[model samples]
Target chain A: MNLWLLAAAVLLVAAFGPALCVAAVAAPERRLIAQNLATVVGALAFLLMAQGYGRSPYRDAALVLAVLGPAGTLVYARFLGVLPSSRTVLYGAAIGVPAVVGPVCAAVGPGREMVKVLVIGALLVAGGTVTSVKGDRHG
Target chain B: MVSTVIVIALVLVGGAATAAVFNRDPTRQALVLSFLGLSLALLFMAVQAPDVALSQLAVGSAVTPLMILLAVRKVKRESTDQDGDESESP
Candidate 1:
């Protein structure tokens, strides 16, 4: 019922979902299991955020980040021929699920805390973008 | 509570940076980056922003490592010559 809780829930989902997708694609023999486990923990945190925040703007923003970030990355990878065209389906799922979740949260209740969460989500996405393209010459 | 979370987030960020610089091997560097992603995810949670953290964990920790590993494998494959015929054929 409370807005903050809904905001938190959205944040958690947006954060963890991509991690799961990544883990699924990662090398099996390497430390993928550990990464998956960690991602699961993060996903649980998002579920909590959804429960607490309910449906709100915060959730909506998270949904955007969740969908866009990975989709964008996948698109770029695809263009470069890193990922096969068939894998785009997974990208769709990654974006679609969160897109649905955001609207559900917003319809239930929109609150101020939602805005704060959205802002933070935006900043994180921006930071992530910078990190991905920036200094790491190793890439 | 927010302040404490922020502090923890900073510490995690620092840890990530430290790990990246200290590790020499590219594979090890990739692993450290995963740790960085995990830590950053916690930092996101600390800030009461779960969505960002989750995404970071996914891409930074999971996807990036996979890509790096793939690249490493490709490099390794290229370096090793499997066919003995190459030396004899010429």
Candidate 2:
């Protein structure tokens, strides 16, 4: 198996699975936090999947997810009034994003595609920051 | 290798979908529904359909959950309003 696919599989099992389990059974606050974590993890997985398959177009889904994940959390906060701050997700993005995006960006090299990957990485970090900050204010 | 990723996605999607259905509260269920949306998008990507995955991420991850939450809130408000009216009338 390719390293990218192996990483994607590991991410799905290590991060996304636990996030899903937390979202399934935890209280509303915890569940929302888990949901937020899922988005970041899922986005990273998509990035890895795109690289694994050698398909540039597949990265768009990760881009869309980076933008949507925070917005979705805000929606839940508005309706449920339970926007607990998730430091784990914030820290995860801050560190995990570059860890994943850097390798992918290096693989793609200097180009418009590289720029796109950088932008998506920035978006993921920004989204994680916004959600965590907003949750602090609301919670 | 590809099949391994696909199988993982499939299992996650199934678990999320089942969780969404089993959760009795609309609000919590909405959360599971969004999770389900995300996993399904992953499944689509694993199967080599990025376009479908993109749309699914847009619609499933956010929009559907937002709609369900709004509907639940509206129904809850109306029920409370009716209860208030009955209490005042009696």
Candidate 3:
């Protein structure tokens, strides 16, 4: 019941619940938006869980997700013939990733671990931007 | 707190799985299925199995949905080609 795990728990409940509801019931475009939201929240929660569990390897899941999540969205957009114009993932990458990654990086201080955290954060933001901007071209 | 996270993850997994089951449309079912994958990964993480979670994230979140969508697209394309009419039929 550490602070990090508590945060992860709250985030999972608050974000994932609503995202699932929308993804299940809404239109494809809206479902894509919710899926984007879920991925962002899931990544952040993974980061928090890594910190809580005191295991740097756990963060790899978040890193893999940072790469896969937006790509998954693009797959949906291409198949569904509609790209969501929502910038939720972009906003989460810019704002939420930093808010979660910064503290973890600081806690880890200067080291290979810190660099890994930074790289994952960069990937998250980059993936989000790609999904958000690419939609403008297609949508 | 770990127990609490686990319980929450379990509930999410249950909800997402149920949603996937109840959705009749294949495309929409694919969306819910992805959500189910995400939650299942979360559950695996909560239970201290990051390895499983990582693989689940790869397969569930991305691969499964992609496969379903591609299959649906192919089926619709072939059906429309056979009919030679695409006026929003089915």
Candidate with the greatest lDDT versus the true structure = 2
TM-scores for the candidates: 0.43, 0.97, 0.93
Q: Each predicted model: what fraction of the native A–B Cα contacts (within 8 Å) does it retain?
A: 0.03, 0.89, 0.90
Model 2 agreement with the true structure over A6-43: per-residue lDDT tens digits: 99999999999999999999999899889999999999
Q: Comparing to the true complex, what docking class would candidate 3 get?
A: high
Kindly list the per-residue Cα lDDT of model 1 for residues A86-138, writing each as its tens digit: 22233323443345345444654566654544443443334233323323122
* lDDT (10s digit) by residue, model 3, range A22-115: 9989988899889988988899899999999999999999989988998898888888777766666668668988988899998889999999
Chain B TM, per prediction: 0.81, 0.97, 0.92
Please write out the lDDT profile of model 2 over residues B1-90, one tens digit for every residue: 999999999999999999998999999999999999999999999999998998999999999999898899899999999999999997
**All models: lDDT?**
0.47, 0.92, 0.89
TM-score of 1: 0.43
Instruction: Give the DockQ (2 decimals) of all models.
Output: 0.09, 0.91, 0.84
lDDT-best of 1 and 3? 3
Off by over 4 Å in 2: A134-136
TM-score-based ranking? 2, 3, 1
lDDT for each residue of candidate 1 in B21-89, tens digit (9 for 90 to 100) = 776666656655665676676567556676676577568755785677678767767766545457668
Full ranking by DockQ? 2, 3, 1
Identify the leading candidate in terms of TM-score. 2
Task: Give the per-residue Cα lDDT of candidate 3 at A124.
Answer: 80
